[model samples]
Target: MEDSGMRIGEVAERTGLSVRTLRHYDEVGVVSPSGYTPGGFRLYSGDDIERIMLIRRMKPLEFTLEEMRGFLDAVDHPDTPGARKTIALIRAEAATRLEKLRRRVGYAEEFLRLVEDL
Candidate 1:
């Protein structure tokens, strides 16, 4: 309930991610909360919320948790030489995923047409 941070439930409501998903992300080292309450409740800062939003954007493109973590690390340390390469790799992967999604949408449209004809 601090002014600078919010509890997990509030973050979940704001981010449209479930509390369980947030906990799992923490457990897996994807996007951990900034701090914890005296009672051990996770408290997330605005930076943490923004990090979670970035991860959410990657999820729909089918990025694995590890991949998401790598992208976040690259974003945080952009001055590192390897960070540029990592980001390029992520962009390539996203492009590939976009192509696959387009193909799937085409198949779904064909399926809808078949259903309409039946």
Candidate 2:
């Protein structure tokens, strides 16, 4: 397996992702493994690990799977002008998500205050 690639379980452990979640990502064409072993186990390379990390970062920003794929595609073709546009879009979306999270935190604090008053 050393010459081939890391197994899915190993990748999950290293990436802190559940096996089911990794499988789902593969199923959804979000982060397919680099290859498969003779026994049909998925093999992930360092590049795949980096890609999964990117997806993980994007998840908190609420990027859909399709959007994640688009981002990954842009990353793969960094020379394209569209890559710059995609990154700008992702940054804008992240700002929006951050604002929503701030609002939710404020609402949670208000709820806590109401409970304390009671």
Candidate 3:
């Protein structure tokens, strides 16, 4: 194992994702580890961890795996006009979803208050 890279287990712990989930991400080619140990263990660098964190954020916003790949590609090439357009579209979609989520949470809170009143 390289001293500069963290093992998959460490990445999972830090990212709050299961080893299985990380493996799935790797298998899907959404996020590949930066290095591998002599024993064939996966090792992730700081940039890999940052990318995983971005994936974690997107999951809650209901971004699909394919969408993730596209978004990451755009992130990697932010200087391109096409990438800029992709980012704009995704950001708009995310905003809409977050607004819907907030409304649902408001409803849930109201229900909880009514139940407490009883």
The clash count for each model shown is 0, 0, 0
TM-score of 1: 0.88
lDDT against the true structure, per candidate, is 0.93, 0.89, 0.93
Please give, for residues 11-103, the per-residue lDDT of candidate 2 as tens digits: 999988999999999999999999988878899999999999889887867789999988888878888879989978877988999899889
Largest TM-score belongs to which candidate? 3
Provide the TM-score for each candidate, comma-separated. Answer: 0.88, 0.82, 0.91
- For 61-87, candidate 1 gives per-residue lDDT tens digits of 999998999999999999987999999
Q: Rank the candidates by TM-score, best first.
A: 3, 1, 2
Model 2 regions lying over 4 Å from their true place = 1-3, 109-118
Q: Could you tell me the lDDT of residue 57 within candidate 3?
A: 94
Each prediction's RMSD over C-alphas, in Å, is 1.9, 2.2, 1.6
